[model samples]
Structures are given as C-alpha cells and as structure tokens.
Target: MTQEYVYDYEPDYDQLMADIETLIQEGNLEGVRNLYETVHSVDIDEVLEDLDDSSLRYFLFMLEFEDISDLLENAEEDLQIRMMELYSTKELIEIFTFMANADVADLLGLLSTRRRKELLNYMKKSDSNILKMILSFDEESAGGVMTTEFISLKQSLSVREALLKIKDIAPETEIIESIFITDRQHRLQGIVDLREILVAPGYTPLSDLIEDMPFFIYAEDDQEEAANIIFKYDLKYLPVVNQKMAILGVITSDDIIEVMEQEHSEDILAMSGVSKDEEYDSTFASSVRSRLPWLLVNLVTAFMASAVVSLFEGTISQVVALAAAMPIVTGMGGNAGNQALSIVLTSIARGDMDLEDDWKLIVKEIVLGLFNGAVVGLFAGIILYMKYGNIILGLIIFASMIINMIIAGIVGFLLPLLFDHIDVDPAISSPIFLTTTTDIFGFFVFLGLASIVLPYLV
Candidate 1:
C-alpha cells in the first residue's frame, strides 16, 4: 500500500495534520514523512494548504521530489506558486525533471512568462522544447493535455524487436497497454495492443498486428471534442496528430474521463449562468468571482422583462386581475424554455444533433410545447372562469398561456442553434436570453389581449 490510500476510507485528516505538525515541531521530519506516506496527493495538498508559510517552506524539502510533483499537480494556484518560490531554480529544475512532461507543462502554464522561461531554460533542450511546445497549446486543447511519453515504433520492426523495444522503454512510457506503429516519417499507421504483441510469433512484422484507428484529432482541437470521439468509439487511447498527420501524442482514456467531467461541469455552470474556472473555491471572493458577472448580465435581462411590463401599465391597471395572472403565464414559459434548452445543449455537445437536423428538432419541440400548453392552459382557464365568472377573462388567460408556451418553445429551440451557427458556445448564454425572451413576449401577449377585451369586461 505504498501510503497512497485516500480519503474514501474516512481517515481522520485533522488528526493526521496534527501529527505532522507535532512531528515537525519536535524535529522528527522522518516521522512527519512516514505519516504522510499513506496520504493521497489530494490529501497531501490539503494538509500543506493549512500550514503557515514558514512551516510549508520547511516541510516541502522534507518530502521527496516525486511527492513534491504530486502536490504541485493537484495544488491550488497560490500554493503551487508558493511551493516553487521556496525552491532555487536548480532545485526547481530537478523537481520538474521528476514530473511527467504533461504535469510540468501544466504547472509552467500557471507561472508568468518570465518565470516559465527561467524554469524551462534550466531543463535539457529536448525536455525544454517538448514542454515549450505543450505550453504553446491552449490548456483546453487536445495537444495541451496530451503527455509526450508514449511508445512509438516503426512497422518494419518484427514482433520480437518490438517486444525488446517495449522491455527497454516501458518504464519510461506513461502507458503501454498499446503500442503505436508509425512510418519512417512518424506518421501514424495503426496501433497494436500489448496482448496481441505478446501472443504473436516473434518473427511476425509489426504491420501484421496493426489495428485500424477509429479516428484521430488535430492537436489544436478542443479536448471535449476528443473526449466525444473516444467515448463514441469506446477507445482506450486516441491519437492526436498535426496538420501533416504526424502523431504528436496519445490521449489516454483517463485523460478523456477528466475532460468529460470538466465539460459536464462547464455545462452545469453555463445553465446556472455561472462562469466556473475553479473548483476549490475556499474563499468568499472566489464564490463572488464565479457568480457576480453572470448575475449582473442577468440583471439586465430582468430589467428588460420589467420594462416590458411597464409598457402595459395602463392595461394592467385597468384589469387589476391581470396582475394576479401574469406570473402564471411567464412561469410556465420559463420552465418550458429550460427543458428544451437542456436537450439542445446536451445533444449539441455530444454531436448527436447538427444544423442539418434543425427543422425537425424545432418542429418536435414546438409540438411538445403546444400539447403541454393546451392541457395546462385548459385547467388554468377553467379555474379562472369558475373564480371570476367572466368568460372573456377566462378565454384571455387561456390564450395567453398557450401563446407564451409556444414562444418559450421557439426561443428554446432557436437560440442555442443560432449561437452555434455564429461559432459561439451555445450553452453559455442561452438560459439568460431564454428567460428574458419568454418574460418579454409573454407580457406582450397577455397585456395586448387584455387591452383588446377591455370593452367587453368593462
């Protein structure tokens, strides 16, 4: 159990942190190291995060460089910077050398350009160039997330030769469940499973064992796009390529799982109108930073809805009853709009729907809205009729409900698609726009009807 057991076992983290602190005070650094040996990287960072600056700086060098890399990878921005600052440039270079290139690149990405240059300069040219190239890619992209450590081979190699090659380099490669076979130019030909390589005759050519790749992505493509392909094809590893079809790296299934979770989180935040960049938001400021801008944008939409109501002030004042029923109409529309928007965004993200399917998709949502509105409106209208004993008012409420619901369906179906057409993220702004739309148009329909029927009611 090499001390990497995590929090799932309900370990008392407070007691552990206390022990580590006690050991540090007594000058028993070895005891502190043994206590943390069983701790997970996340748990290690959590304990480190609580330590005062002086204690943190002292304890960093107590742990091995490998453990240091783990903490740096999972730690918060401030903690990562602080930890790096405690180490000299030479020490930082040694620490980074112990990390995977992908992890090193990720940490470098958090630093300022000048600091990044200093660290990269300290590393060997080959490693420095690879990390630099990775840093050049957007962290949200396939190239950026991919680890450069992978097994690559020439098709000309026999199975025996490939096996010897894997034995020599397997420790250095990140994963070797499969080996990539490429041409002399390093253009990918196909992938072969380790299982297949082991069972085949030693004399068998590597080309004979090649499995057809379902798909490959460009390095610059979004990580979520790569995730979708890997999910759809059930691939364990997906190849990333450059424009020339030279294989850059493999995006493993683990990476895809992380990407999928991040994409899901983004969608959830988008629907809630929050822009999320952090998960370990421990402070009031972080919570406010995530939500305040979206709330401000939504305030503008609320004002638009309020303005729509103000336009009908005369009509609403005349039929004071309309004020009582206005919420019923807009509330139904907002709910319906959210339902359709969720479906659209999910389908678009999964590549299940495209612009070509727009007409049919729109027709289906609208029909669903109409059916739902008819049933709901009928009940509400009957209730209003029984209460007010005014057929005109009942009929007016009924018509308003149906019109608003249909309007909800239209905006829900069209807004996301429209955003996507303009190359914008469809999910991010749809909810705010959808709610405002339903409110504005719903008010117009209800108030306009009230104005028309005023003479009869009076």
Candidate 2:
C-alpha cells in the first residue's frame, strides 16, 4: 500500500498572514519563500496588498524575477506602480521578459511617457516593438488586451510540421491551447485546437484540422465585444485580426476574464454614484474628491424636492395626517423607480435591450408599475381608512400613490435610454436623475392631491 499526503486546502487566511508577517519580521527569507510557494499567486498578491509598506517592500525583494512578474501581473495598477518603483531598470527588464506582453503593455500604460520610454530602452527591440504596437491601440480595444506571443501556422503545413513548429516556439508562446491557421499573407484562415493536431495523422494538412467558420474579433473592436464573443462561444482563446483579416494577436480567456471583472466593478461603483477609480483604501483626500461632486448633485436634487414640499405646507398644517403619510408615497415610488432603473441598466450593459424597442420596454414597465402600485396602494388605502375613518382621505392617498408610481416607472425607463443616446454612461447618471424625478413628482402629486382634499380632512 502507498501512503498518501493530504493538504489543508482551506487553510486559515488570517493564520497564514500572521505566519508570513512573523517570517518577514524575523527576516526568515527561506521560510517565507517556502510558505509563499505553497499558496497561489493570487492569494500571495492579496496578502501582499494588506502588508505594511516596509513589509511589502521586504517581501517583494525576496521574490525571484518570475514570482515578482506574476505578482505584478495579478496586482492592482497602483500596486504595480509601487512595485515597479522599487525595482531598478535592469530588474524591471528581467521581470518584463517573464510577464505576458499584454500585462507589460498595461503596466507601461500607467507610467509617464518619459518613464515608459526609459523602461523600453532596457527591453529587447522585438519586445519593445510589440509593446509599442499594443500601446498604439486604445486601451479598451481588442488589440490593447491581446498578447502577440501566439502560435500561427500556414494552412498548407502538414500536421507534423505544424506540431514541430509549435514545439519549437511553445515555450515562448502565451497560448498553446489553440493555434491560428493563416494564409501566406498572414490572413486568418481558421483555428485548430492543439488536441485536434495531436490526434490527426502526421501527413494531414493543417487546413483540414481547422474548425469551420471559427470565431474571431477585429483588433480595433471594443474589448467588451471580444469579452462578449468569448462568453457567447465558450472559447478558450480568441484570435484578433485586422481589416485585412491579418492575424495581429490572440486574446486568451484569462484576459477576457480580467476585462469582465473590471467592467463589473466599474458598473457597480458608477451605479453607487462613486467614481470608478475610487478605491476603499484610497487616500482620504482622494475619496472626498471622488465623492464630493456626486454629493453636491444629490444636495441640489434634495432642495428641488423640498421646493415641491414647500408648495403644500398649508395643506400639511391643516391636515397633519398628510405629513404622516407623505413619506410612504415617495419611498415606495422611489423603490419602484429604482427597480426599473436597475433592470434597464443591466440590460443595456449586457447588450440585451434593443434601442429601437425602447417604447415597448417603457410600456411594459408602466404596466408593471400600475399593477404593483394598485396592489400596494389598496392595502395603504385600507389602512388609512381604518385609522382615520375618512373615505375621501383614503381615496386621495390611493390615487396619489398610483399616479406617483406611474411617474416613477416612466422616468426610470426613459432616463437610461436618453443618457445612452447622448453618449453618457447610464449607470453613473441614471440613479441620480431617477431619484430626483421620483422625489420631485412624488411630493408634487401627493401634496397637490392632499391640498385638494384639505377641506374634507380638516
């Protein structure tokens, strides 16, 4: 019988961090290195992010070039800059060789142009040229996120020859799961999986192994488009081509995964009225700077809602009950409007909602609002009637609730579409605008109705 060793897959993160900190403080380099080797690079990056600046620098110094490169590739932009600053030009050059070209380009894009040029001077001419080419493309394009290190073979090459070529360059290539088969002019012909080549006859031409009508994206296309394609097709690797269909580079699934995560984070932050660049651990001044503008906008909208309330001060004074019930109307309406806004914004982000069918979505939301409002308002009306013994007051509250909810639905559904049409991000601005609309209208309608029924209540 063979003895087996089982590892604790769910090791306590806090305990591991404590151990790492002790090792760092004691200057136990070998122990730290051994401990780090047991954890994944992503976990190491997370732990490094939490470490104090001095400890982080010391730990980074102990990492080999390959380990440092992996950390830099996985770390956030600010951390990447900090690590780069700690490294000398020669060290940076050595680390860059181990990093993927796409990662190198992204890291360089964050540096000052002068600094980028200086760093480039230390890299090989070929590597520097690839980074420069990637930098030439917009940061949000397929070309920008793609790695130039991919295996490509002429369609006419036999399977054995292609395998030999792949074997020669596999060590340098970032993606070997799928090989691009191109024409003599380097035009993308199709894609063939490495598994297919392994199983095919040695004499079979590479073209025979090509999948029919393989999916690819243009290098200049939006990075989101590439991400969407990868998601839709469940792809392992996607080829990037130019207008002439010439293969420029390849975007592995890992690149698209990163893009998706970034996009989701940005959308979530924008929806909360925070700047996408604002991090929780950012400097206090930066946090204030990032948030103050949105707060100011909300303040203005709050005053507008107050202005509507001021118009009905007399009604509230005469019937104190109106003031008691006022918040329910506006609160429910605001909640309803936000529901619509959330759905529409998500649909827009996922490219699900058609612009031309805007009216249909609006109508659907309106109907939904009316149905929900009727159910909610009925209970509210019944409660008011039982509490105040006034049928007219109950009727007024019911009508106001329904009307405000309808307003909420309309405003919420249309604002995002309007913002998108004007080339603004709907997620960032929609909630602010929708809240303002619901508040102003919710107060106006509820108070205006209360005033009309003031004689009966008083």
Candidate 3:
C-alpha cells in the first residue's frame, strides 16, 4: 500500500517565516526552492510581504529570476517598486521580459524619470515600444490595464487555420479563452470563444463561429466603466479598440477584479474621511496628513452645532435635564441620517439610483424617518417621563425627537445628491455635510421646543 502525504494548504505565516529563517541561516538554497514549489504563488507573495527588509532582500536575491518576476507581479505596487530598485538594470530587464507589458509599464511608471529612461534604454526596442504605448494611457483607463498579448485572427481564416494560428500564438498569449476576429485592416469584426472553434467543423470559416457582434470598449474609456461593462456582459476578456475601431489590446477579468477591489477600498476610505492612498502600513506623517484636513473640517461643523445649542442656553439653565437629554436627540439623528446616507451612496455606486429619482427618494426617506422616529420617540418619551416625573418634559422630547428625525432623513438623502450634482465625490464629502446637518437640526429642534415650553415646565 502507498501512503499519501497531505500538505497543509492553509497559510501559517509565523511557521513559514521561522522555516525560511532556518533555511537562510543554514544557507539552504535548494530547501528554499523546495519550499517555494510547495506554496501557491499568492501565498508566497504574502509570505514575502511579511518578511523584514533584510530578509525580503535576501529571499528575493536567492530566488530564481522567474520566481522573482512572479513575486514582483503579485506584490503590492510599493513592494514592486522596492524590488525593482533592488535589481540591476540587466536583471530588471530580464524580469520585465517575463512580466506582462501592462505590469511592466505600471512598475516603470513609479520610477524616477532618470531611472525610467535608463531602464527603457536597456530594453529591446519592441518591448520598449509596447511599454511606451501602455504608458501613454491614464493609469485609470482601460488601455493602461489591458494587455497586448491576446489571440487575434483574420476573419477570412477557416477553423483549422484559426486553430493552428491560435496554437502558434497560445504559447506567447496569456488570454486564449476567446479569439478576437479582425478584418484585414485590424478592425474588430467579432469574437469567437475557443470552445466554439473546437466543436465546429474544420472547414467552417472563423466568421461563422462568431455568434454575435464583438462587444468592446474604447481604449480611452475609464477602467471602472470597462469593469462595469465586463460585469454586465459576464465576459472573461473584453477587447479594447482604438478610435478607428481597430483592436488595440484586451482587458481580462483578472484586471477588472483588481479594479473593483481598488475602487471598493477607495470608496470605503473616502467615506471614513481618509485619503485613498493611506493604507494600514502607511507612515504616521502620511496618515496624519490624510486625516487632519477632514478632522479640521469636522471641527468647524462641530462649532456650528455648538452655536445652535447656545441659542437656548437660557432654557437649559432653567432645566438642566435638557442638557443631559441633548445628546440623545443629536446622536439618534446622526445614526438615522447615516443609515440613509449609506443606502443612497450604495445605490449611486451600483447605478441603481440617479438625480432623476431625487424627489422620489427624498420623500421615501422622510416617510421612513417619520415611522422610525415615532417608534423611537415613544420609548424615549416614556423614559424621560419616568426619570423626570414631568409629563410636559416627556411630550416636549417626543415632539423634538420626531422633528429631528424627519430632518435627519431629508438632509441625509439630499446631501449626496447635491454633492453629485456639484461633481464632488459623494462618498468623500457627503458624511461631513450629512453629520453637520443632523447635529445642527437635532440641537435646534430639541432646544427651541424646550424654550417655547419653558413656562409650563417651571
């Protein structure tokens, strides 16, 4: 009987680090290579990221050139730049050759102009030209992320000829799920999946296998727009065409996934009043710089809310309980407003809601606010009455709570729409504005009502 040895696929970061340390101390290059072979590329990349600078440099230097190239490609942008700095020009050029042109261009774009020029001078003319073309597009555009290494065949070719051509190019191309069908002028005509070609008769022309018109995006289109189109169509590879409708490159699903992740991260960070570039491992100065501006803006809004409270200071002096209860109104309003803000922002991001639905959405939120306020106000009023033994105070708080909640819903729904209209990112600026409105209105309503009913309470 043969015994099967099962390897643990789950990543154990500390154990892996210790093992690597032992291997390095013993100078076991073969053992390190064996360890690399056992781990998945992404897991290896994670392990490399966890290492200290010295350990990272040593491991990177000891690895095969191909392994280093793979690691660079999978690494974060900052780490890729660091690894690029570590390698000599000749070694960098060799590593670049193994990487996709899009990734090579991305790494080179991060380098200083002098360094980029020196590296570009060492690369082969053809590879340099490809990198230059990719660098020409904005980093957030489809052309920047798209790869030139896609299988394209003339529409005139027979299935057998197309298959042979694909076979020849398959070794060089990264994406073979779909073969782009182009005209003599290299204009995109249609696309045929490789499966269709495999099942079709060899005598069938490639054009016949194209079930529908080619769905492609322009090179200049925003990467997010491209990602949305790919998501909408459920495509694995989306062709990028030039202004003349000629095939330029292809954006794969993997690229779209990366874009989606980045956009999500940016949106979440923006909502929290932090810069998109500030990561968990960012320098203290960088993090402070990113967050301080927003905090300052919030401070101004806080003062504004404070000014509203000052208007009813006389009423508060008569009844100190009003001061104690003030936070409840403002805090509840803030929470309610945030809920509406989240819904509206998510709908806008997904393209489910637009400015045209502003009135409809605002009215719906206000109605929801009214219902929620009534429920919350009922319990709050009962609590206030029990605590103060004053029915008048209870009724005053109940009315104030209801009015503040209504204000919360209205302000929350409108702020994002208004920000969108002014071309400001709703995610970044909406929370600042929404919280201010809720705080100001919550304080104003609660205190104004108390002032009006002060005689009855005393």
Candidate 4:
C-alpha cells in the first residue's frame, strides 16, 4: 500500500504537478491517480495551469466526469471556453450530464449562438427544452440562475412515502434542505424542513409537517429581487413559481450569493464611473467604447470644478496658501459625499429604506454629516493654523470645511433619491453629479470666506 499525500488548505502545487508529470512519463497512470486521490480539486485546478494544451486535455480525461463538472464550474471563463473548444460535442454532453442545470445553462450561455444551438440539438429533447427555457430568461433574472431540478413532494404523501420518493430522486436533485410541498395541480403549498420529515413518524402526513411559504417569487423577477427576498425573510432557498403558483424551480443560497456578488460588483463599477461591460471586455476598442462616455462626463464636471476655482483667482493670488488649502476642503467634501452615497444606494437596493420613512433617513445622514464635519473640521483647521501661522485662515478653513461637509451630505443623500425618482440608476449617475456639487460649493464657500477676510490676512 502506498502512503497518500494529505494536504488541507494549501497544497504543494509544484510537487503535485511534478509527481503527476513524472508518473505520466513513466507510464504509471494508475500511480498518478493514486498520488492525487487525496489531493483537492482546487489544487488540481492550479496545477492544470502548468500543463500545455495537449497535456491539459489528457489530464482532464484522468479525472472523473463529476469532478470535471466541478472543475468547469470553478475554472475561469477563458479557460472554460478553451475547455469547450478542446472537447468534442459528445464529451461535453457527457460532462453536462453530470452538471447542474444552472451550470449547463451558464456554460451554454458563453458559447456562440450557432455553437450553443448545435450542442442543444444533441441533447435529449427534455434536457434541451429545459436548457432553452433557462437560457431564454435574462441572465439577471431568477429563472436564469435557478436550477430546474428540485424535489417537490405531494402535500398528501406520508413521511415514509416522501422518504421513498426522495431516495429515488435525490441523486438527480440539486440539493435537499427545504423540500417543497405541492398539491395535485402541482401548485406549491408550503415547504417542510428535511429535519422535520426525518424526526416525524414514518406514517405522518406531509401536510401536517408543511409550513407556510408566502415568500415565493415569479420566475421573471430580477435575481437581485430574489436575493432580497432571501435576505428579507431569512430563507435557505426560495421557490420560483409561475402565475399559477406552480413551482418552476428553486433559487438556492449559492445562487443568491452569486447574485449578491455580481450586484455589488456592478454597483461598485457604476459608482466608480465605469460600466459593467468594461469588467469583462479587455480589448482596447471595447474598453474605450464602454468607458469613454463616463470619462467624458467626469472631464466635463472636472472643468466645472476648475471654473469654480477661477472665480477665486484674486484671493488665491493674494495668499498662495489658499491655493493649497482649497483642494483639501473639496477633496474632503468629495470623500464625505461618497460615503453617504454608498449607504443610501445600498439601502435603496435592498429596499430597506421605506418611501414613507425617507425623511428620517435624510435627517439622520444630515445630522451625521454635521457631527463629523465639526469634529473633523477642528482637526483640519488646527493643521492649517500650524502650517500657515494665521488664526483667521484657520477659522476660515474650519468654517469652510463644515459648510462643504454639510453640502456634501445633502447632495449625496438627495442625488440618489432624485435620480431614482427620475428612473435613472443612482449608482451610475450620482457620483459624477456629486463631484460637481461638492467641487463648486466647496470652492465657493472656502474662497468667499477668504475674500472677506483678505484685509486681515494681508
């Protein structure tokens, strides 16, 4: 018996790669399998990078189809595309057989229309139809991310009967946690925890075990909406339904997690004045096309900020310190506004902030802005006083900082609300507008105060 190499989180990738290569060279394929038997699939994914095209293809055949399905799921998009190119349709179909419906849809989505159609043609009509239906949904909808395979028990079934049914179908099911209960019409009634079924007597009726599940969503609902549903109700999984209330599929925790991450990424991109398309499009033309519009918008706002500065040129000429100090006010204001914007945007996205209660949130943010400004402005003012040896200048800095912070807060809070009301995404348009507001006001207030106190400073 050969001793197995056991690794936990971090595996020695170089050794694994070398050992596998050396075994393959020595014609000990069985030894290669045994050597990697205890190795993690993720570690295998890393070692795969060292292999050339031919070797990589050969190495894939050594792994089980189930493992390949997982690898395909974990692999980067480019590599996944390459893997698709490397495999014949038959081989891909075999791998797809082991993959979840959602995973198959995702992979199929990456393929060209003609190529995807070709693969679909080879699938069983049942599987092909299911895949087509899932693919037909917008990539950001609940149906797009949901796995079509799930266990649905008849509400009238006994515990023993349900257990027998699950046993027969569990292998084909995505996961078993909260099993959905449905009527004879296939309309979902409720969901019962698997634990409840296990604890109940074998003869106990499923209807007695079922609990109310008023949290189901239409298949056409946004994936983010589905995610919100999960968060709002603390659900493990949400059932997707048709207008008839018949179950179409299930959105599991994994799907919710993906939706959240993608949404956050999209929001971050939008806030940063970047498009979501730019994230995946690395080509120079694609980069320019996706990013140029926002860059131009920012440039325009930047000039507006500069124009505000030009109005204070006389004060700036008299005291050069004003030139250096003015930016600190505007920069700090920009930072403050961004902070408020992030909170408001997240609240709006999650539907946590009620329309009726908007005033409470607005007042809270404004107060927070004033409190932060007073404390932070004091520190900034002290620093200015020490640097320039002028009390009036320090006081001006202090006052201006407070004023700009307040303005930043108001703009940040209202900008998103205004844009959302007007049917524009606050995430995409708010940042640019906030930059202009803070810059113009920040310069005006700071410079206006400096002009008034110019005689004392001189």
lDDT of 1 by residue, 57-123 (tens): 7777678887787788889787998898888888888888777898889888878889899988888
lDDT of each: 0.84, 0.85, 0.85, 0.86
**lDDT, residue 427, candidate 2:** 88
Give the poorly placed runs of model 1, Cα more than 4 Å off.
1-8, 278-296, 386-391, 456-458
TM-score for all models, in order of appearance: 0.92, 0.90, 0.91, 0.90
Off by over 4 Å in 3: 1-7, 46-55, 213-215
User: Which residue ranges in model 2 land beyond 4 Å of their true spot?
Assistant: 1-18, 50-57
Better of 1 and 2 by lDDT: 2
* Clash pairs detected, candidate 1: 3-37, 3-38
Candidate 2 lDDT: 0.85
lDDT of 3 by residue, 1-458 (tens): 22222238876877777777777676677777777777766777777677778777887777899988888888887777778888899989998778888888999999999999898888899888888889899999999899999898999999999989998989888888888888899999988889999999999998887756557889998897888878877888788999999998999888899998888888899999999999899999999999999999999999999999998889999999999988998899999988988888876765566786668767788788888988898889899999999888888778877888888888888888878778789999999988898889888888888888899877
Candidate 1 weakest ten by summed lDDT:
1-10
**Candidates 2 and 3 compared by TM-score, better number:** 3
Worst 10 residues of 4 by lDDT: 1-10
